[model samples]
Target: MKGFVTAGTLALAFVPGLASAAEPVCLTQAEATSLVAYALPQAINGTAKRCSAVLPAGAFLRQHGSELATRYAGQKDKYWPQAKPAFIKTLGADGGDAANLTRSLPDDSLRQLADVFVEGLVSQRIALKSCDKLDLAIDLLSPLPPENTAGLIALTMEVASTAEPQVGKIALCKG
Candidate 1:
């Protein structure tokens, strides 16, 4: 959060007053959901009919969509501390376990942001098999901000190579 930024492509390149001086603002679970909702539609074509066909935005996403989309679109590489508030709020009590599980994994947002980035993929029959896995895109290469991107990629590669999913596995990250 303290250092001068290394600029990258993604949304951060165009957003002003961010990526330097401090870490990017982290997206809340609600925000992530909303932004993912927002991003999902754009990422996938003809998907809106399905989402709208479903349960709707639910309560959290509907109320927080605009602000969440702004923060998510604005800050992708925010520092851990900066990202913490939103993560905690989003994950609630479940966060402690997830954070602890991947504490030593990596510094990038991959382990955390991956799910956020690609949750919508689960809805798609094709994206899931095409590019949803950690090996395909990796976290750093993902559209997310930089702080966690590189580290997340490393973690994903490690996980993909070493671990095998047994149960219903959902890696939690914000894409």
Candidate 2:
């Protein structure tokens, strides 16, 4: 996970002067932060567990938004039985609950995970047409490997933290 690239690193991954190619999927810092805040929870909550593949974040999202969403939509109705069961199962698999997994990590680790999660979501939003459809976005973003559940939860906690005010405020479980 430490070796995984961050947003700024993704920019560097492109050739110099090809700014459009490297331009982050989230257009602004606020948008990036807001997207991270919104998507992190749904990801860890297990709604995405059915996701079996690892999506390429960053430019992939920028280039293939609609195609990715359509491919991941699967058979579930746009309106579903509910997403909570998946979230609960994901949380349970990680550590029995969100608090148990998140409360124990070092603060810096959580923040680092938050940074990575932010990059992933911004890329996801860019690919999915700027987060217009919550269900679709959730499906597209949920493709994270199951091994990252703890990291995802830690990132969610860091985003939700009140002490580090720069991350901005987030509302979880809106439904």
Leading candidate by TM-score:
2
Model 2, 1-175: lDDT tens digits are: 2112222222211111112322212122222223323334323222122121333344333344344434433322321222222222222233555746654657556444443443344343332222223233334444653223223433443333223332222222322
* Candidate 1 residue spans exceeding 4 A from truth: 1-74, 78-81, 93-99, 109-118, 121-175
C-alpha displacement of 41 in model 1, angstroms?
9.7
lDDT (Cα, 0-100) at 30 in candidate 2: 29
| Reference-based TM-score, model 2 | 0.25
In model 2, what is the error at residue 89, expressed in angstroms? 21
lDDT of model 2, residue 37: 32
Stretches > 4 Å off in candidate 2: 1-58, 75-79, 83-158, 171-175
Q: Candidates' lDDT values, in order?
A: 0.31, 0.31
Candidate 1, which ten residues in sequence have the lowest lDDT sum? 1-10
Question: Pairs clashing in candidate 2?
Answer: 45-87, 61-127, 65-127
Report the backbone clash tally of model 2: 3
lDDT of 2: 0.31
